[model samples]
Target: MSTKPQVSVAIQWATEADHPPFSELSNAQIRRWVRACFADSADITIRMVGETEGRQLNNDFRGKDYATNVLTFPMEMPSLGADSGLPTFMADIVLCTAVVDKEAKEQGKKPLDHFAHLVVHGCLHAQGYVHELESQASLMENKEIEILKRFRISNPYVLEGTK
Candidate 1:
């Protein structure tokens, strides 16, 4: 018998918006994404912020001036215990709600669906996935597609006008 790794997610809403309810960022939803792409048990915090803070974080960490939909900050820490076979993963995922809302509208996608994709994408990054190269991007994208499929979400890379 196999067991899934345990995931603890703490969601922080740093910005105010008349968007969906906070329940949308449920633990089950987050655990599903984390488990799909990672083998280790994790402690993750997801923060929803406005464009200003998001842009500042992006600028400081990634050197990008504009705010991105999501940013993953993986933590470097020691293991919990030696006897525990599972590794402990810790990360902070920041979501720019305004950017997510804007991008969803522009892309003709549901906000919930787009949010789910970004969450999954950010979790994968916490597990060391990257898209800095063409091959790496393809691999990461394929993993995202498979995980999103389980959530009944279509491939996010497929835009509205594209075949």
Candidate 2:
């Protein structure tokens, strides 16, 4: 009786930077995080990289000079042709391990918890969700909050230990 969207998730750890073999960043956990955000089936690849590579990608693609916590690149929409039940959604979500860890400490949040939020945030962007406007941002944040609750994670925008 599961209505979750089916996704083909591939995890890639392109940067070793001491990010080895952690249960929090396991494939199952990543898949669950993405599934929680998707309304339709998707083919997603999540990659973790060091700050250098992250900065390079950001500068090359987005014209930014700094590494970010998460970056999502949505691929071209494919045809849902006859006899093709495969998902048309395709995207690659990249997490900069150093940046994420740094942000987690700065924000007083657990690294894994922040990772979950970023994954969900990136997934939503891949699905065409945006926070460029106030209303849209509110809607997206609310969606993220609800999704996080399923994993017993608190509202990310709210300070921990306060309500």
Candidate 3:
């Protein structure tokens, strides 16, 4: 009677960095983090990339100029109706490992902990979560905190001085 959602995740590592080695960020670890966020069955691909690919994707799709920590590309609406019993949500979650490592160091957080946060964040985006508005951002941030708490992780939104 585990309450976890049925999420099928495919992990691809395209990064050449060694900050967080394969042993530190395994596919099972990624899948576990993403699965914790889903309330419905999902199909997700988690791709780890380097700065070049990350920057290119950000420029081409999001029109940004630098590599970001994570980008989620949710698939279009499925042709099959919701009643078809297929996966209800689908997306590709891209994580720039180098950026993630740097951010984690700057934030005074563990790399693996930060990785979990990004994976969960990206998965939520796949399920149509957004943080563009203050209200929406609050809700999304709270949800992330709640989910992360299940694994004994602290709130990512909290500033260093608060804790």
Candidate 4:
């Protein structure tokens, strides 16, 4: 039997974009990605925001002055809770629609595919996966490739003419 965790995803759209369909960003898809990366059940909230909010949050929290594609905020919870049987992992993933669109176009990637990759990347971050070091980055990227493959998406790190 699979030991994948149960996932509860909450989506918040703070932008007025009619491009990417809702079905592409459904809870089931997000849950599947989370389950693939994490062994513990997770409660994750994905917030889609505009450039302004994304920039502000990035600057305030990460000290970066630009609006990135996705920002992850993992919530650490105490392990002493004995009541609820819900997942212990929790996180808030912020996706900047404008940045995602722009990067997708620049990278010659489909918006849905880019979004899927970012969501999976952010979910991995929530599970304490980081790419600060070369070894860590390789491990994380391999995991991402494996997960995206299941969704029939190509490796996101591959550039045009390099494959």
> Could you say which candidate leads in TM-score?
3
117: Cα error in model 2, Å: 0.3
The per-candidate count of clashes, in order, stands at 0, 0, 0, 0
Q: Report lDDT per candidate.
A: 0.83, 0.85, 0.86, 0.83
Per-residue accuracy of model 1 over 1-163 as CA lDDT, tens digit each:
8777777778787746335633466656765666676666788888888888999999999999998999999998676584665457789999888899899999998887898899989988898889999999999999999989988999999987788
The lowest-lDDT stretch of 10 consecutive residues in candidate 2 is 15-24
Q: Is candidate 1 or 4 superior in TM-score?
A: 4
Please list the residue runs of candidate 4 whose C-alpha ends up more than 4 Å from where it truly belongs after superposition: 1-4, 16-28, 81-84
TM-score of 3: 0.91
For residue 150, model 1's alpha carbon misses the true position, in angstroms, by: 0.5
How far in Å is the alpha carbon of 147 misplaced in model 1? 0.5
lDDT of 4 by residue, 1-163 (tens): 8655677888787755334543356657766766676667788998888888889999999999999989999998878663578577899999888888889999988888888899999998998989999999999999999999998999999976797
**Model 1 vs. true fold: TM:** 0.86
In model 3, pairs of residues that clash are none
Clashing pairs in 4: none
The digit string of per-residue lDDT tens for model 2 on 1-163 reads 8676678899888745345323356778888998888777789999988888899999999999998889999998867672487775789999988888888888989888888899999998898889999999999999999999999887899877777
- 76: Cα error in model 4, Å: 0.9
Highest lDDT against the true fold, candidate: 3
